[model samples]
Target: MNESSDLQRFQELIEASAERELTEVETAFIGRMGFRSEQCRQWLEADAEVVAAAVEQDPLRTVPAATTLDWARVDAGLRRAGALPDSRAQSRNAWPLLPAAAALLLCIGVINAILRDGLSTTPQAPPEVVAEVLDLPEGDGSLILHEGDDEGVLMIILSNG
Candidate 1:
């Protein structure tokens, strides 16, 4: 039969198989069409060694097929073969860089602290401002005081009774 007819037959077999435990007629029909035993194996009791061989040969084999196998070993093998990147080396390499980076940062911080402390603690030379005396307007009792910083008091006399 053509591919289209084969596909149609395959779909009908799957729908019939889903309704109940596979009947002999369905199994015969499936086997005649050269279908894989993987789905049909569910209808029969599987040998442990046979199932394990399948899992060992192909890690992606069905999980129930793998139930009889040593999973940890298979899992490790699959991870090694799979695309998952190995991060152990990267993590190990990064750990060493952390202390080095921390040491660099500590050195920079210590240098900055020393510079800041030195700049702040050292006294600055006293300032000098030019001062000139000026007269107040008549009848306005005002006093302007220059207390070393060119800034001081400016106030009017209070006429307290």
Candidate 2:
């Protein structure tokens, strides 16, 4: 059985059109469902028969009323058989925040661009270059460390400039 085509036709009939005017695809589906196309076509081809027989027919005179069938097993069995694995794939949609995100990023970019010029133009004072040129509390001349016994040393040469 062409499960995909049959399912697609049923879906299209439910979504695209009503049951009154069945397309070729929908006819094929009803055929698979055990409905005779020739019987329905003969009934439809009879104009006076439709108006007088189907429409004007007394409800009490009919032997039995229309009946609805329960087909729960079809869907459950098809799912077990993996008839339409990709059916759920069509329903998923990506997040819709891209345009808003782009706008927010553009605002941030504009703000950053505007502030960059101001920050770059701001005056920055040069380093003193002579901090702690005097001696320490214990007569230390500079920020230097002297070690012994194979220890490390940190030397800071002071400049008057």
Candidate 3:
């Protein structure tokens, strides 16, 4: 092949190398061309450096084992620095009982209101209800009876025919 064809084949081989491994013959051709041409030699050197760097082990990649901690010592230091409250003072502070006390007071108020307004008065008589019988078509019939919204105070009946 002439010089132009040689250059074209070399270019094709270089482009192919980017996507797949070059064959031994193609690699030998590239090496021979690199030796004869300054630009090819520089490209080959740059590629070699890139591959070497990629394959080299990184020193920072391996992580060191975690150091053990003394939690008692850490707590002591924090207390000395006033970053944490004293253990005795924390226990003596009855702030945690405030929620329970508020809940007790709310219960007492609700009971007092119920006693004042709900059960102390005399009970009233219930209004009278008129019952009606429905004439349904003759078929397979079912009657369903259930308690109403007032639980034991009222009842509801449904019939399907």
Error (Å) of candidate 2 at residue 15 is: 44
- Better lDDT candidate (1, 2): 1
Ranking by lDDT: 3, 1, 2
- Return the top candidate by lDDT: 3
Candidate 3 accuracy as TM-score:
0.25
User: Which candidate number has the best TM-score?
Assistant: 3
What is the model-wide C-alpha lDDT for candidate 3?
0.56
Off by over 4 Å in 2: 1-96, 119-121, 124-161
Query: After TM-score superposition, what is the CA distance of residue 70 in candidate 1 from its true location, in Å?
Result: 6.6
For candidate 2, the lDDT comes to: 0.43
Q: Model 2 residue 158 lDDT?
A: 31
Pairs that collide in candidate 3 are: none
TM-scores of the models, in the order given: 0.23, 0.18, 0.25
Query: lDDT (CA) for every model shown?
Result: 0.48, 0.43, 0.56
RMSD versus native structure for model 1 = 24.5
After superposing candidate 3 on the true structure, give the runs of residues whose Cα lies further than 4 Å from its correct spot. 38-161
Q: Could you report the Cα RMSD, in angstroms, for every candidate shown?
A: 24.5, 24.0, 23.7
